[model samples]
Target chain A: MDGFIFSLIIGIFIGGVCGYLGTLMLSRKMALTAGPLGHLTLPGIALSLIYGFDVSLGAFPFVILGIFLIWLFETRTKLPMETLTAVVFASGVAIAFLFLPVEQAETALIGNITRVDIYGTIITSILCFLIFLIIRKNYHKMVLINISEDLAKASGINVRKNNLLYLFLIGILVSLGVRMVGGLLTAALFAIPAASSRNFSKNLFQYTNLSIFFGILSSLLGILIYKFTNLPAGPLIISVSSLIFLISVIFKR
Target chain B: MGKLKKQVLKMFAKDKKIILKVKNLTVKLDKEEIIKNLSFEVKEGQVLTILGPNGAGKTVLLKTLLGILPYNGKIEWKINVKIGYVPQRVPFVKQIPISVREFFLLKTTKEEAEKILDKIGFEKRILEKRLGDLSSGQFQRILVAWALVKNPNILLFDEPMTGIDVKGKETIYSLLLKLKKERNLTILLVTHDLNIVFKISDYVICLNKYCMCRGPPIKNVTPKTLQKLYGSKIKFYAHK
Candidate 1:
């Protein structure tokens, strides 16, 4: 019971944070970037496992580095973000295979929410809430930047600064999420809720709020189901979120 | 000789206060010089229209002047002056739903957004309309309203009326003219619409990669100036 409850709490926090960040990413059409970045955390996780360190914290630096590479290429090379993400994805997988023990790869890829301790859950939840508050406060600013960089600059909003800050925050959120969703399935937590909410949201506020709602719901429900059925929590949560997304598309309000 | 000198100074003087000055400005993207050694001055209450055809660096000049793009040389705005800008259009991606009100509220309050929309002749109901659902003309006006809410001393536009119909263009043009007179607002409008050059310009700067000619529309915008800027004979019948 205690383990189930812990898993549920962690799932909700990770899921909600992913969903909120997803809104910003999806606005920039960066869905592809999120998933690949999740995979890129593999070598970090491998190193953490080898060293007996905290895997999520260990994965943090690598994901942030991956984000920096994407941002660097975006500004300097002007290559499409998709192309940049692909380069990172290839390099990340290769690096992971080199360091990752084959026996542990399954657990690393699929994720095990049972591994998160109480301190880890508490810290992650607090971080998730903090990111939510910041994003909520800066919602309109984010939209303006997404709408047009030139217009935002004229408004005295530092478009580049805002973009980098958002990307940095994304690196943090994605890192925190990797432990629960595993690297492969974490992207769905970020993407599915936002995608579903976008179909019916009348304004930015609703779009964002509903995304968080669906994200929490998916995490909570998926965890409960995992407790009863012994299925992997990460894929089950993503499946639940995807089902909601499909239903939203079918109804299409 | 003193009288002649005074006459020449009077002929040259644009206004009492120079609102914006671009001196020997150059913008190079990659290897290509988009704008080269361009110089101009805008006064506090005059409309400065940058006239050029497609790929003539009109938009480049506006971006450079707005300090959105890096460029060589000096861009000086009078102290305490605020700037507003309207792009040709903001891409309204279908995936993310954003309302007109939410967009305006990015820079101002809901009440202020509604008021600005009304001032720009958009209906109050438009506040609830999704930005993606707006027609081209409506979208253009919404952008104008977006900039107007800031109450900038100077407004810069880059092809503000692109994709808007003729009537919509006339409406926006007149709205801008009204803004200039009523508020004494300085405007930098970039356009390829030679047809409306005579109609909207207080001053015209014809540019290719360089300033071909610049002065009051009634004087500097001549057939020779057009030929120099566009590299061809183009007839522009002055229309009221």
Candidate 2:
């Protein structure tokens, strides 16, 4: 496949996974956390760039650590996720700057599709599919946790363990997703499709399906636009995502 | 003490109607004690209400029994007794596109949800409606229906009537009465409303940081217990 086509296929797969994860964040009202988490990838990318490793592999551990800290703070302090996200992300970024060289910041912030290969694409596809199966199976349990931990516990669900598991799942999505959308706009990949679909869905299933559809569409279109225009693929994808959201809002109104 | 209680619980092993028993329950949060030494027993097919003021740790106590919070106590339950909980408020964000039917399907099958909603005085039409669109009373009924879909033998409610008005409370309580009679279910509810205590509770637990008084409302509830709970002089009236 040509570079353009290869990039397009990879972008759609990544965006779809992001969209799926975004629905949970939006429903759980933790979408904003994704923004800082995306930025927090800087240190990992910096280390990987310095060491000649893949960006995703470099960024993985820190994302997992960030999620762990957020989950711990939330349960212990009973503070809202929004507040915890801010604290965690701010500290994460501050530390990231320590390791990240200034010159490579732009390259790290705007993802380059030329970096993706057949091996990376195959691996990402497998990971995304595996994540999908897991999320589908646990959708109800996670929703129960989202609504009320008390209710989930009352129904004999393991609230704490499942909650931590969910954070880990989102953590994986962030590590994989930041490579395609770039650290700056990685979160938009999760939030935009979900926000758009929320305006159009009549039920939960429709909401999820529509979000995924939009995810694939925005990703593919964004890559096409970037290839022709020679613009940054990350911002191009976010623009398309935003346009879809605006259209949905109009339809909802 | 824990060992003795476990032995006693094993001794009461065959008494299936004793749905829940908590002995010397204690809960602490953020290194501060929220629930002090508390003990309570709930029998099958009884309405037990935990009455207390704000910050009296009623929520903390209910959560402790449900195992949602770590507690230093023995909470023994009759074997295989399923529980359903209806929180005073759930975090929906009021924007997620979810129907009542879809929400119920989260934990139960469609047929189960239909029957539960029917029992909760909702018509089949309401199932397709968005949860965000439901009226306060309707939403409250749906909360009950959501729990019923779990097919629980016991229901634990934490401030189930928090945002409901007086008229709405009446409708909800009536539904509770009807369900209790029809299903022979056990109920443990936490509330700050004394009037509700007199009207519906078979047993009242006046709690402030811990259980102040616990017994049949008529025999054990008095002006002194009310004062101890609310720290305010109040007139007493029972639903005749």
Candidate DockQ scores, in order: 0.62, 0.67
lDDT of 1 at B35: 89
Interface RMSD for candidate number 1? 1.6
For residues B98-179, write the lDDT of model 1, one tens digit per residue.
Answer: 8888787788899889877777777888899888888888788888888888688989888987898988888888888788
* lDDT (Cα, tens digit) per residue for candidate 2, span B204-239: 888888778889888777888788778998788755
Q: Pick the candidate with the highest TM-score.
A: 1
lDDT of 1 by residue, A1-253 (tens): 4677788888888888788888887888876677778889989988887888787887899998888777777889888777887888888888998979998897678788888778887888888889888877777788788887778887878887787788778888878877888888767878899999898687788888889999999989888888899899888898889989988899777
**How much is A142 displaced in model 1, in angstroms?**
1.5
Give the whole-model CA lDDT for all candidates, comma-separated: 0.82, 0.83
For residues A1-253, could you state the per-residue lDDT of candidate 2 as single tens digits? 7667667777888888788878888988888877777777878888888888888887788887777677678778999877887887677678777877888776578767657778888888888888888888887888777777777777778876887777787778888887887777778989999999999988888988999999999999998899889898888899999999999989983
Q: After superposition, how far is residue A85 of candidate 1 from its true place, in Å?
A: 1.6
Runs of candidate 2 with Cα error greater than 4 angstroms are: A69-103, B1-10, B13-16, B93-95
